[model samples]
Target chain A: MIRSLHIAAKDLKAEFRTKQMLNSMVIFSLLVIVIFSVSFGDLLGDSETVSQLAPGVLWIAFTFAGMLGLSRSFASELENGCLEGLKLCPVDRSAIYTGKAISNVVIMFLVELITIPLFAVMFNYNIQGLLGLVVVIVLGTIGFISVGTLLSALTVNTGTRELLLPILLLPIIIPVIIPAVLATGKILVNGDISDISGELRLLLVYDIIFFVIAQLVFEYAIGD
Target chain B: MSTNSQKINILSILTAIVMFIAAYMIFFYLPQMRDTSGQLLDSSFKIFYFHLPIAITSYLAFFVVFVASILYLKKGTHNWDVLARSAAEVGSIFALLVLVTGSIWAKATWGWYWVWEPRLTTSLALFLVYLAYLMMRQAIEEPEKRARLSAVFGIVGFASVPLSFLSIRMWRSAHPLMFGPSAQGSSGGLEGTSLQFTLIVNFIAFFLLFATILAYKVKNENLQEEINAKKQALP
Candidate 1:
């Protein structure tokens, strides 16, 4: 755990210095939000329905952005040949997996936080649901990043990883996406934890399940 | 060569006969669901016979992949790798068939091409999972690494099936009864004697068909391996 934290801290310091993954995800998310606002502008007469659709739209943007961040999480390591250096260390492989996953989640969380307000302003929506949206985003991001981290490791060594990462990652993440999207929509509407308890519980379940599975399989994935 | 030719001929003949019988049962033998006025709406409902069997066989195909993958990881044998690949290919083919037939049936029953319903969505997810598996297998060039990576993926992919099914079912509330009769998706869908018999026969026929296809696929892979070995020996 300590070693994992060191790895996470290392990645965090590097990410803060460069912010390559961070920049693209933020810009990509804003693009998605703008596109969605344009697409839905003509359909709905009132802002109420559009506001309600915010959660779904927000998630779609976050997911697309998250995909790029996940793929790039290991790309740096691959390019710099750092994975071999890490593998040569007397450390459990899963520590590296967990470390990368945590960094991905943090980076994704920052992206989501920035996107929410812009998303609200662009769509003419209220920020009363901002806190709830944050919670949903946190839970959803952790679940997705956990799976994405392992998959990035799996495909990072493969050819055309840009294509392989999303192809393999998306289908497995469907179970996570369904519950998270449903829960987010509910939370945005009611702005309370009690009402969306089912979605919340399902999201937690999905997060834990995928997180543990990633840990167990991380060895087989990158084991030489 | 003569024995091999004769074996192929027998398997091909058996598969053809069983396929025809299945087709016949679907069209002529199965009892159609009775309408509100007790009239038979028999023709298009026949797709259910083929539809459900193919779905079951697709699941069976994945089951083979799961077992073979486990064996490959355990024994590190080339045979298990080949079997896993064959099963995955056949499985993806059936999964695609299930989607096409399902879409056709959905069009007939729901008056729409697709819905966010549980079973339909779940089957779509399953199809995508196996498609990804195939793509993963192709992405890697090294045979050993490819086999190991895909074996690991095959295991996790199969495990996701139930989670995908449950999450979608719970999230969507209800769209349809999943796998029941066309209009009345409530009860066991197999209402009458003929309907039951036809479903059973078709299932048996599909099992036979699955076996035949898998056998041929594995045989082809083995033959390809022999040819490669012979070329290597020539040098």
Candidate 2:
């Protein structure tokens, strides 16, 4: 675990130095929100409908942005043979997977932090139960990144790296997306924890299941 | 080669015989279904026999892929990888048939070709996941690398099936539940022994059909591998 943390720290250090992926992810998510706001401008007048549509739109931005970040997570490693260096390190192979997943989750959270408020302002809506909403987003992001990171490593070596990631990742993540969207919608509307217990449970289960599976299979994915 | 051909011929002949029996039972041996008010239902309801069996067979195919994938990863054997690929291809085809037959049944019963129901959505997700699996295989050139990466994907992709299966039970689903306890009641289940027997016959038929096709696919993959070996040897 500590080794994984070290790897995570190294990735963060590199990511912070360049800020290229972070910047693009944040801007791309914001643009998704902007475009959504523009297309649904008329519906914004009706806060009722906008609240109904908000969760799906919000998740779309997060996932699309998350995809961008994930596809690049390993693509960066291709430079200077960094992935090979990481593989040669004195640690378990799963450590690399855990570290990459953690970094991907952090980057996704950062992007979500910027995107959420902009989304609220653009749609002129108030968010209730901020903490619950945060929990939902966090679990959802973890679930997405767990699978996304592994698939990113897998696809980075493929001929159509960018195009293949979403195709490969999206269908697998449907279970995550469904529960997260439902929980987000409930939290947005009522802010009631009791109401969304089911969605929360589903998201928690999905996060754990995929994370462990990804850890077990990460070796095969990145193995030479 | 003779033994392989003989085995395939026997399997195909058995599949043909069982399928004919199943078709006969479905069309002649069974009575038409009726509504709660004693009104005769549309003949389209017959598709349920085919639809249910195909869906179950496809699920069975994916299960094979899942097990074969884990074995391939564990043993690092070429045969397990071939089995996984063949099962996935067959599973993809069966999954597509589930969607197509399902849509036809839905249009006849619900007066719509499709709805975003949990069962339908999850089935589509299942199909797309395998489709992506196949596409990923095509994207890679190296046989060993392709096998390893796709084995990992095969395991990951199988995770969706259980979740999708549970979604119908977890949520308010419009899709009919034929067995076990269902939220919408057990009205959709088979009623008489004849109905149940026909369903059983169809199940057996489809399972045999799946086995036959899978065997053929596995043989084809092995042959392709041999050709590739020969080409490499020539160079």
Candidate 3:
């Protein structure tokens, strides 16, 4: 586990130094939110409309932007031959998956941090129940990035990285998206936690299930 | 060569006959759906027996593919890979049936051919995922690598089934399950011995059809292998 964390920290430092993945994602997310605001300008002027759309905007922005990071993350490892080097190290392949999943989640979580507030401001929504909203975002991001990391490894060796990720990832992550969106929508509308707990629990269950599956399957994806 | 060709021809003829009978039963024997007002609805209710069976079969095919994928990775056998690939191919066709019959059902019941309802949305997502897996295979030139990557995807792709199933439950505030509480277990539309009889026949038909397709695909793969081996030996 500690070894995995070391690998994860190494990835984090490498990601920060290159900044290619992070920069592209951040810019892409911001652009999506900006475009959303412009297209739905009249809709955004209404508090009700903005509140309802906030969760969707945040998810779409985060989900699509995160795809940019996922497709390149492991494919680049294959491109640069870093994957073999990492495999040669004395760590379990599942640990490598764990590390990568952690880094991806961190990057996605940070991106969500920026995108969510921007969405709130652009749409003139307060994001009342901010604490509960953040919990939903964190859980949802966990579910998204867990599945994303596993899929990135699978698609890394495919011919077209760009086309494969969304087609492959979107279908698999629907469970994550539904509950995340529902929970966030509820929080946005100021619904009681009692009303939204079912959705939240579903998201948590999805996150745990995918997290475990990704760990077990990571070895096959990375191995020849 | 003549004998092998003759066998395949016979298989094709048998499949054709079975399918013809299935279609005849679907169009003739199925009862029309009556709304709450006791008015007999249009002939479109005929699409239900066809649509629901195809949908159920497609879901079953995906699950089979998922299990086969896991076995392929564990055993590293080409046979399991063949099974997985064949299941995926037939599953895609069934998915097509699901989409078409679903559209027809929607037109009959909801007055719109496509509503993006929970079940429809999930099935659409399943169709797209299956297509993506096939496309991924086509995109790869290396056979072994293609099989490995696709198997991994096949395993992961199924994870979305439940997600799509639950999405409707989460998002729709007003619309409840048509039949019951369980997301996919609702028997609202089908009642009495009719439901049981239809379900059993559909399962048998789908299974036989599935086996026929699987055999054909495996034979094709074997032929391709033989041709490849012959060409390599000549050189």
**Highest DockQ model number:** 2
Candidates sorted by TM-score, best first: 2, 3, 1
Model 3 has a DockQ score of 0.64
Fraction of native Cα contacts reproduced by each candidate: 0.58, 0.79, 0.60
| Tens digits of per-residue lDDT for model 3, A36-57 | 8999878866787777777788
Taking chain A of model 3 alone, its TM-score versus the true chain A equals 0.95
RMSD of 3: 2.9
lDDT of 1 by residue, A1-224 (tens): 98998899999999999988899999999999999989887745576787568778888898899998988888789767798998887899889988888888888889987898898787776656566666777888888898889888888788888999999988987867877877777766667767677777777887887888778778878858
- Candidate 2 residues lying further than 4 Å off, grouped into runs, are B183-187
Model 1 misplaced stretches (Cα beyond 4 Å)? A39-45, A48-53, A128-132, B1-13, B35-39, B167-175, B178-189
Query: Model 3 reaches what TM-score against the true structure?
Result: 0.90
lDDT of 2 at A4: 94
Q: Which candidate number maximizes TM-score?
A: 2
By DockQ rank, best first, the candidates go 2, 3, 1
Write one digit per residue (lDDT tens) for candidate 1, span B17-129: 98899889877775557866778774767788888899889999999998998898888999999999999999999999988987887788777778886567778888899
Tens digit per residue, CA lDDT, model 3, B38-68? 8887876666666666777788889989999
- What TM-score goes with each of the models? 0.89, 0.97, 0.90
Measured against the true two-chain complex, the DockQ scores of the candidates, in the order shown, are: 0.60, 0.85, 0.64
